[model samples]
Target: MGNQPMIVMSEDSQRTSGDDAQSMNITAGKAVAEAARTTLGPKGMDKMLVGSSGNVVVTNDGVTILQEMEIEHPAANMIVEVAQTQEEEVSDGTTSAVVVGGDLLGQAEDLLDQDVHATSIEQGYRQASEEAKAILEEQAIDVGADDTELLEQIAATAMTGKGAENAKGRLAELVVDAVTSVADDAGVDTDNIKIETVVGGAIEDSELVDGVVVDKDRVSDAMPYFVEDANVAVIDDALEVAETEIDTEVNVTDPDQLEEFLDREQEQLRAMVDDIVDAGADVVFAEDGIDDMAQQFLADAGILAVRRTKSSDAAQIARATGAQVVGNVGDIEADDLGFAGTVSQQSVGGSQQLVVEDVEDASSVTLLLRGGTEHVVDEVERAIGDSLGVVRITLEDGKALPGGGAPETNLALELRDFADSVGGREQLAVEAFADALESIPRTLAENGGLDPIDSLVDLRSQHDAGQSSAGLDAYSGDVIDMETEGVVEPLRVKTQAIDSATEAAVMLLRIDDVIAAGDLKGGQIDGDDGGDDGGPPAGAGGPGGMGGMGGMGGGMGGMM
Candidate 1:
């Protein structure tokens, strides 16, 4: 084997090592970051992603855009994961996290070119990340549960430039109310707050319901359209007549026998209705279907019944009304019933919906969001979701920070000072980490049509002047105090973004080689074929079908 290249791997396998591997990974990560950079601030633009099936999603939510892109590059996918993790952890700052992660890789590339070891850069980044989180924690302002104004500001900030800016004020108030209504000493559970979007009215028409709104109608038109002082019964089982599980045949010797059999079925249905009436339940939400006979019985009893309700809706109603879900109709009793001040069937967007409202000691609430069109409603829903998340996080953590890129600028300034204290090659890496964090404010300025360099300079000067809350106002191209501007975000958003972005960056930096094995054809591996293959498919592992490591420079160009 003297000087001969060993062919232990398949001939079709491709390998990228040294600087080439690092460059390819960095390029992919940057592309992923750029895909979300434009959707950052109050003046940021929206992305209209058209799926292969012609489905279009119009919004600036970073996680939504990344998830819809269906990215195939392994490195790019890692950046997307950073956004996803941020979204799951804080429900906001996904765009900021992805952008920061991409910029960190970009900054590390400069160090690599200067012959800095990958381990040194990774160590420096880890150190900077921990310190950055500490700075954010120290800078956060304490928020109390009674601070309604501050909570609204946090919600409104999350909604800015995400397609609900036009009605953020009203939406923010509703978000705060919905979140606080369900909050307890333990913490706030966002899942208790449901959002129902209807396309037919202006965004300002959105309102908060004290209880729950389910997208279901009365099982029978004969039932009362509305019931006041309602005792609600939530049923997980069907109201229909039960049949024997085993196959059985009954021989009827006379017509009277068949008539008696049919009469028995009617009696069974009436018995079910009687159980509900006996329980003093004026409203019924059934997870399974209600028989026609049961519907007629309920209607005659002046009871409102909604059938085929989703299990989630049923559970929410049970929580809202303080009612228990009964599995058997016969088992329903007054003790198992939940009370609602009113249960009504209202027509919304030309569709009927059951609204259960005004429950005492309610634990669940709903936001009825209205928009003029389907697409508009969809974007509004996304905006409202983010707002709810931030508000819930703020209430839970009881700490928030000024928004509008204020936290990033402050973190950058502090990290630079920290770099000066540590005099070594790692110091250069720490300073580079500081520069990468400045990308947030820079991207915000660029997306708002302001000069990034000028905006960044102004931000640094403001920080140096001891005004840590000062940040760029994207709409006015001015640096103002974010807290005074009513721009605030949960402290978790900033810290989580820093932690996730830095982890992703350090993980990518530690990589020095990439080996891909597949049946390479025309310099591209087939992503569709994976059966007893030597390695994973193109998109599954490595950069096989993504035009190879060197050819992936332009792979994410069409993401937006």
Candidate 2:
């Protein structure tokens, strides 16, 4: 027989379960946080994550990274949720949240080595978390009107790219002002606001216009270029022209036949156009159909118009402007539309747009967007949306607390004290939570590349000296004191988040060897399939999660 090389492979698969789960969770949480920890401050760098599908994303945003990752481990997903919760609660502490969560595991690991039971550690963690939050609040720096400049600095911190620094700074101010403007004793209108743009593409003048610019010509010949005390009408629902279909059969290509058909169509269109203009509609947004002849007639009648509009947009305009769509131009009435005392028309970039003031009230503000390229405008729009939608909501809900890592540092100490107060297994979990909370300022210091020990010492000293801005000792760290306003979470939300996260961690950590310890441990097979549970589970968390559950008793299995 010819000589052949023998190959050997390990026969036993290393089943990561029980304590392995907790350990893995600690590892993954730390890994994910370390991946983004460097991008904490303004000088923080970006990460380029190339997905299996060849998709590329370069960002240090914790939420984005968690979302983009095709995470397989259940414990890693927990880390992602922690980041999400932090972002939701504070809008600016996601990186800190995750890093601290990892740190808690690290500390817990040490405690475990000392032979501390999982139950005891959990109990301690709970107590510590409570203490930490209290400390954070008490030690927080007051950011009053004097710190307005700091707000700008913080906004700049969030911005990137070419105009990011400048735009973000100005935008931060605008955000404060806009928020303040709409905020009565009640609050800002966080849900409803509008932004629009128009381009003069087809006209001789190619340029940019701001503030609800539209590219259509004004309708009618007799209307004033600037109609002061003009009533406004927004037509969104129906064209209200002729419901009757133009079903007539005309076989003749002759000029006379064509003329007859055209005349009938023109008459029908004119009737509809005339109705709206006569109804005192100085402005019209037609969501549906409108013929060229009818538009020309309205122009002749001096009516401002936008043709072929999106129905949703048209409806909003009507709601905002208090206008209606008349069935025919001849049937217009004054009361159906909104009253705008001052109506101004401007033609920029070959586009004609009407600015209506005092439509329903004077508080309405529209941001006019102008750009030389579509990409610029698009990016600007996205930036504005992100700020308004995600960032603003987060701030509004979190009470817009101040920045500078003060609250975090204070909270950490409080957690340490709280853990000391609690007893039993619950204390272990609480201690973990508290330890995680305290890690924020340290991470910030680390990210800033500051001498953490010195910075922390200075921070404590500043607090003792009543510097008003000092909390933890990171005052001397290379970090900016943006707006450190008092941002408080509603008790309900705060409780829910903490409860859900801690519960998930504990419950998941309780399993040992999923197959060996599960109900189907004794070679229990499905009626049809040979696999346990009749199938090999589905989605991300199946038997895989249960396998790690064994770590619960040891405080390591749940780490998955």
Candidate 3:
């Protein structure tokens, strides 16, 4: 009953029976819950979680909070799973998951007082959660299959807080059309398209074209002869080299002296022209005006040079090309090509065309715009992101099931029916599980604190009457309650908490040995607390507060 090591057992190292592990789980689950309690609703405040090293995470999101809490307890880790599962089930309901899981533990604790066994509670709780999940899935709102409404909703919402609402919509339409067009084209690669925007241009200047835009002319008149494989260069500094390594005052006596200086300049220019020619760069973009001598030298080298090109254009060219030609000469390589193909310049609003021909494949891209203003664009992006995340989650876990609480709900109802048919502890528990699933809507209604019950009831009635999207509700009452509209929540969090708590409490009651706290890593209880020197400790609960207490509330307030 004593002399056990106090090392915490890693979950992988432990194989304790499910019933034997519950005692420690109860506290851990609650500890996880505490981490997310503050951020629950639109009115919910964000928590500035600071880690030991001072990294700060500021968010009102439930999942983020729980995830941020550095928890070390095994039982507390389970709550994270519950939230993760809920998040997977429904994109924006992580808070509901943790809250419900915590409450379920709380309720289960009461059950433990009434002598329920750990196994009994585990089976019952899981059964109830599964049934509840099935029920919610049945009532989920379905956007019409062939309807463009969802698409429009996504685009429109993406621009909501974005500025230039009308402009944003127009841009989104253009983007959608462009992407759809690319998709329909046989020769085009849908994934290859990109949208590159430059902010210095005016709003009227923001037009889309088939190819890349480079705001420069040919580097020099003698640039390449229609390069089939172009190598573009962007020189940020003056291509001319500095006078000499040593600084000296020059004394020019006459025009002949000036001519001598000029000759030296031409030599430097000739060297630059030779490098470009040898490097096989089809185009050279320079930021400053090219001297007549330099221009003439480039012409002899058969290289096209564009002088006075905007520095930004030069940068884009450098990025597009693998060649480097800064202050002096540098080698160009075949691997410098970032894009597989380039587009030839078709003058669009004064911007020069970047002609790229011959690629292994094609690419397509569409940029949805919310507004011209930065803030509006940000909000719109956030909304669209929410929808994307939601879609991803649904596709991953919740496949389309038979409609309208028809199969699963009916099956759940029948389980309850069968309990009436076959009487047993499990039978009763299974039936109760079905009822618990049904309670999700009820809790939603209560949270809404409105006639959501009536609205939800009507929705079900409407479904019975052949109404579509019946799972969606018009504002029934409180903002949170309106979640019944299309929120499709899982089982209430409180119920999960109650279940886990009871399971833990019952498991703890069966402990007898005072093995060193080694098993406590996962789920542990004081078997027989031996006081120091081989005597029994007066208190049996061991030292308190060893539970891991991290938390997260998956993000909340996401749109669409």
Say which prediction, candidate 2 or candidate 3, comes out ahead on lDDT.
2
lDDT of 1 by residue, 189-305 (tens): 887898999989899999998779899888888889888998999999999988789999999999999999989999999999999999899998999999888899999999999
Off by over 4 Å in 2: 1-17, 20-31, 47-61, 68-92, 101-126, 137-163, 166-169, 195-227, 237-260, 308-316, 323-336, 341-358, 368-401, 425-431, 457-468, 471-560
How do all models score by TM-score?
0.89, 0.65, 0.47
Q: Tell me how far the alpha carbon of residue 481 in candidate 3 is from the true structure, in angstroms, after superposition.
A: 14
Task: Report the lDDT of model 1 for residue 521.
Answer: 31
The digit string of per-residue lDDT tens for model 3 on 1-560 reads 39987866653343433433444455456555555644443223456656546555555456655666644455566677666655444434455456555655555655565666645655665555454455545654443323233333333322322232335445544544443444432432323333444333333334444433444456544555355455565555455645567888889989999999888877887776676666655556667667677777777766566677676544444433433447544443333323324434444334454444343323333232323454334434333333333333332332332222222234345456555644344444555444433333434444334454574565445544554333322223322222222233122223333344334433443442223344333212211122243432222122432322322221211110
lDDT of candidate 2 vs native?
0.50
Range of the 10 consecutive residues with the lowest summed lDDT in candidate 1? 520-529
Best by TM-score: 1
Q: What's the C-alpha lDDT at position 55 in model 2? A: 50
Q: Which stretches of candidate 3 lie over 4 Å from their true place?
A: 1-24, 30-60, 84-92, 103-114, 124-146, 151-383, 392-423, 431-474, 478-544, 548-560
What is candidate 1's local distance difference test score?
A: 0.85
- Please list the C-alpha lDDT of all candidates, in the order they appear: 0.85, 0.50, 0.45
